[model samples]
Target: MPMPAQEIEELIRAGIPDAQVEITDLAGDGDHYSARVVAESFRGLPRVRQHQLVYEALGGRMGGALHALQLTTACPTEE
Candidate 1:
């Protein structure tokens, strides 16, 4: 089954309790998503690493139940 946006947000929040997560369903299908994740913990990480953190939060669900995710990550200060 395709992953729901709420589930995605939940998983991310579970991983980063202080994170602000926003998930949008792209293509009107649950299989594709766009997520904006902002966290204080991301302050020192590079962009690639930031994305990795969000992916890790999904517990390996990407490409399986989650399919594709276009993710954008930033520190809280980045706005």
Candidate 2:
């Protein structure tokens, strides 16, 4: 089974409660996706680390329910 966009968002929110996430299906197959996330937790992390956090949030689903994810991570902008 493939992961739904809402489910992906939920997983990311679970990882970073205050994260602002946008998810899109890239292939229309539910396996390939793109996600943009902004969160306070990512304020001091490197880009690689930020992506790692998102992958971890999926709980090792990278090759299963979730396949390819083109992810963009950023710290929350001051407002």
Candidate that scores best on TM-score: 1
Name the candidate that leads on lDDT.
Answer: 1
Root-mean-square deviation of each candidate, in angstroms?
Answer: 1.5, 1.0
lDDT of 1 by residue, 19-79 (tens): 9999999988899999999999999889999998888999999889999999999887642
Cα lDDT of all candidates, in order?
0.92, 0.91
User: In candidate 2, residue 1 scores what lDDT?
Assistant: 86
- Model 1 pairs in collision: none
> Each prediction's TM-score against the native?
0.94, 0.92
Q: What's model 1's lDDT at 38?
A: 91
Per-residue error (Å), model 2, residue 37: 0.7
Please give the lDDT score for candidate 2.
0.91
